[model samples]
Target: MANPSRVFAAVLPAAGRGFAGNEKEQVLEVHTVNRQSPGDRVREVQVTGTAEVCFPADRVSVCVSLGNSKESVAEVLSSVSRRLEYILQTLRQHGVSDKDTVVRRYLHRAADLYHMDAEVVATFSDFEKMEQVCSVLLEKLDKSVCVGTPQFYHSAGCLSQLRRQVCVSAVENAQQKASEVSQLLGQSLGPPLVVREEETKEWRNEDGEFGSRGQGAALLSHLPHRPTITASSRVSVSFSLRDKSRKQL
Candidate 1:
């Protein structure tokens, strides 16, 4: 039976609507469907096609966190604050500005030793600046303020633009795919009956992860930046079949 629900959100609460045993009923229905024999299978499924397009990021947001531990919270924060100030200086020297940077987090945790963790972030004029920033931190932050490295991001405006561009490209890609399939089947592409969307997340500065140091700790050589960012999307679209005698959907 076709689900009357229009959206995924609608389906979730559909069974929960002011019922005493709604969850149990839903479980039973799910089990019943699982046990039911295979009814109709669409062997020739027209997968809604997917298209990917990459757009250069105009601005990048990054988060750089620093942490250290001593005794008192004041001592911890003061140590971190100095390192952070130096980092800001390094970035500014390389053409990055305070306006392009923002402080993200400042917190203290009770550990074996006194500790301070700070999250300072900056947007680069160019992505290459990120490399220099990291390098400077690795070199300058010696025996103090353990650097957690920087995280990369794209602004919402950039993401929104890509979504629109990718969506249009996806629709065209679907049409081309359906047309090819139709031709191979000795038919013409019928007007599309249904369209759906799928997307994959990706990162802005896909540059490889920040370099790492070998095993064994020497002040600040054990922490490695685990940079895993991938943006990908998949779409599936199907066109209805129509003959000269049949009307288009």
Candidate 2:
């Protein structure tokens, strides 16, 4: 019997050859190299793996708008300023720091009415304290002050950390999948050859399939019961493989 693990070279004619000079003018080409045995073939497997992580929202931003209309610009400014001061004082009394508050004042004349508006923004880590501040503004403060629903989002630092952790988990999942596939093929999983991250998607679990709140009005009524933020990471990984027969030998 002949050894199957042999490599041979063969010569063949090139395509589109015609007689140019004398008889039997042709072109010779070398092509079609194949391994005599299946064991000589190189193997690589590509797998895509995804991982998702969920965490509760850690910070909240409370937005409040106050406006006053008066006969004189000075009077409207004074009233709005006083109300804004009171709102700030109330926030401080509830443990909100100055660094966490933002205030903007605007004045304009509309149809002989001196209009003054103030927008106040504050961020809080404690939901109870935030709720307290909002309640006080709506109940104790004058009706001139308007409050908008607080928008909920995860902290930037928290999201950054989650992305890193989820990417690692996704790669691990890819490795596990590759190992399973290698086992099924009776091959040993070798070192990874390539790694590529596909994408990372993050959203609130309460949003359901609505995606972002800015997408449409259809998701306006759904409320998040869990205040949970979910993140998913996808990765494509290529890994080399070693034959089981070689390992056994």
Candidate 3:
């Protein structure tokens, strides 16, 4: 009869056949059979997507100030109060609500003179109206009133909408990439298996220009310099892959 060791060596692969003098000590590798059900054998593809969105500043706040000095506290108060009332009245006439206007006053004694300083900070959604109001205040109050430059910013609702929009755009971009990949692999793209926002970034563009120095940037340079906030989002998404032939069945 043929030797059992020689029979074992004949069945072994070429790389595993060279065991001399230590046949009993040599180890054999056994691969476990995969018993996973067909339903559990799902194939997935993962892709990363990113998007950036720029939003112009919408709301504006302007400060209007007045000061008065007199020998008596009552005189100073009367003088400042007259200008303050006029400022509030002007804002109201321009459709500014009381909730959007804030008034602050400070009283101090400089040497023997009583001094009072007051200011009203008003927030406006209408830019044209804001410009008209500023012009009216400067013309009527003249040097008595000082109107600061308008500070532009995005409202809470605007920022919330921006964040949501950027994230959704990133996800859509990822799905597009996955679809192309599936097509290349001769497969059909199914619904998403997993989706996660990997990162988010926000920054202010003080110069109000895009990052690229291309033609788009040159065109934007000629536009009004309204500082903008840019938001970016990156997402990782996994999509299920289906055999195109299986769909017909």
For candidate 1, the 10 contiguous residues with the lowest summed lDDT are 28-37
Question: Which has the higher lDDT value, candidate number 1 or candidate number 3?
Answer: 3
lDDT of 3 by residue, 142-222 (tens): 999999977888999889989999999999999999999999999999999999999999998876534456777877664
Using Cα atoms with residue i matched to residue i, what is each candidate's TM-score against the true structure?
A: 0.41, 0.59, 0.76
**On lDDT, who's better, 2 or 3?**
3
| Model 1 bad stretches (over 4 Å) | 1-48, 51-85, 103-119, 125-127, 178-249
Clash pairs for candidate 1: 48-235, 48-236, 48-237, 69-114, 70-114, 200-232, 200-233, 201-231, 202-230, 202-231
- Candidate 3 has its poorest 10 consecutive residues by lDDT at 1-10
Candidates arranged by lDDT, highest first: 3, 2, 1
Q: For each predicted model, how many residue pairs clash, with residues at least 3 apart or on different chains?
A: 10, 0, 0
lDDT of all predictions: 0.63, 0.83, 0.87
Task: List the candidate numbers ranked by TM-score, top first.
Answer: 3, 2, 1
